[model samples]
Target: MSDKAPKPLNLLDYHRPKRLRLKDARIPPLNAESKRCLRNLTAYRPSRPKFPYPQTRSAAVLVALFVGRMGDLYVLLNRRSATLRTYAGDTSLPGGKWDPEDRTIEDTARREAFEEIGLPRDKLKVPLLCILEPFLAARNLIVTPVIVLILDNTLRFPFSLTHSPLFSPPLPRFPTEPELIEVPYHTTNEWTYPGPNDTTLTTRAHRFLTGREAGGIKPVFGLTAAILIHAASIAHARQPDFEVELAPPEGQSREERIAWAIYSSPVFHEAYEAEEIKVDWAKVAKTAGGKGGGRSTRR
Candidate 1:
């Protein structure tokens, strides 16, 4: 009314560019719940008589839990080189027996991971997921499996002489098959020589005592399987809607087709494949809230 032609309605009020701009913006702290859930999970302790079996020696294993942009989760596994002394060409977690320099079982897991897979501890945003009870399978040693969540997407690994060339490749996505597999413990009953013994020595050679089968449980049985089952339970409890369908072509007989599906599935491949299901990122962004868009505009 002050002779300014009604002071023209405010641009923000009429056009609302701020609101539209915010409509397309992504959610802040994209990994908030994941981080929190991992934290709470680490704090939990399983009941006493923690280990069901008796262990004669101490050993450790690590399960690398990685979450991708599309919210898909994966675990890292290494295939031992066929030329190795033991467990050659077998799939297993990246870990080994505790060293004298190690402080805790966690330290052993970290150190072993660094040595076997070349994943630097600094590059990972790993939170302790869980500590599984020790498992024994005809072996004289007790094995502990530790699970950790890897939050960073750009993580990398280098190949070592003892590992297979396949695992040397940069793994930005999950593996198509089960990450870890247990093989039977190779042993021999032949006696070893003991020089100048009054009584003949009958020492049985049990060289590969630790490399034992996981019984009848999808080839990844034993302590490693226990760790996975527990971690899956925890994740399901937090997000009931989260589902993990196997990357299709599960039983296909064709090698090429199976390999193709493995490398193309959203759960496996780093690059998008035609067969991969497309997620509506816009809807997700809006649900998370844009900068200035009306809260109820979606309706």
Candidate 2:
């Protein structure tokens, strides 16, 4: 091995959010980006293991990303069964408690996803590209977000009218347990990435809400939404077209606020402000004086 230390990234300009895109099939490109960019990614170590209690339960959620039927990217989400004892009927990523049989938290994520949704082991490509910072859900549990990418070629659809990773066999079969059945997976409820012309983009000021009694999607608020937004942003980095706009907005949607909170969480902010993630992504505009790196950034 060469005994050379990597050169540091020059952030004077990288700090500003710019439209970004990578022209490659692989998400998070298997090959290393420029040395500076690659090295900067190393600086971001998600903040966790902060608590000392051994009995405190540890949980993991898979922020599974894949090409959708129309070629656009989509993530998997589920509504909790109304009968479940906790957070029943809430929308969430596929996951659960870390199991002793699992070798790592990532294993917990995959295992739970398999048990809960029947995602075949063959569908998964990269088991883990990176792990985001751990979050404490509204409840007391410590939850970790695991990012997994599906093989672009493995997914197939009946027809190619508009998307990729054809999501045929529309819904996954749930386990026999009635409690698990309460969630009742539906094809219509999955969150759609807002395209450029999406009506939601028109305002950029309003929050997307879920009406519980109306038989709509379970609201994606708080930590879950934050993790998703974070994943979506990173997923596109490998595309030759990904870019961030340089602007800020007054406090608006709960998502921008929550995402900013996680990104600026004491641990994340320290690494970010230091440009450990490469460029100093502008502070979310909602902050008192900082300009948000991305404005109205929709999937």
Runs in model 1 deviating more than 4 A are: 1-40, 49-56, 165-223, 237-299
- What is the C-alpha lDDT profile of model 2 across 1-299, one tens digit per residue? 53332223221111111212233334433323232232333233444321121112457787765544444444666666667787766676778876556556666677777666655444224334466665555444456777655655554323211111112111111211234344532211213222111212111211123324265555565566556545544443332121221133322233343344433345433423333233334533333233446422111
Alpha-carbon lDDT of model 2: 0.43
lDDT of each: 0.42, 0.43
Q: How many collisions between residues are there in candidate 1?
A: 2
Cα RMSD to native, each candidate? 26.1, 15.8
Candidate 1's displacement at residue 226, Å, is 4.2
TM-score per candidate, chains pooled = 0.46, 0.45
Kindly give the number of clashing pairs for every candidate.
2, 25
Using lDDT as the measure, which candidate wins? 2
Q: For candidate 1, which ten residues in a row score worst on lDDT?
A: 8-17
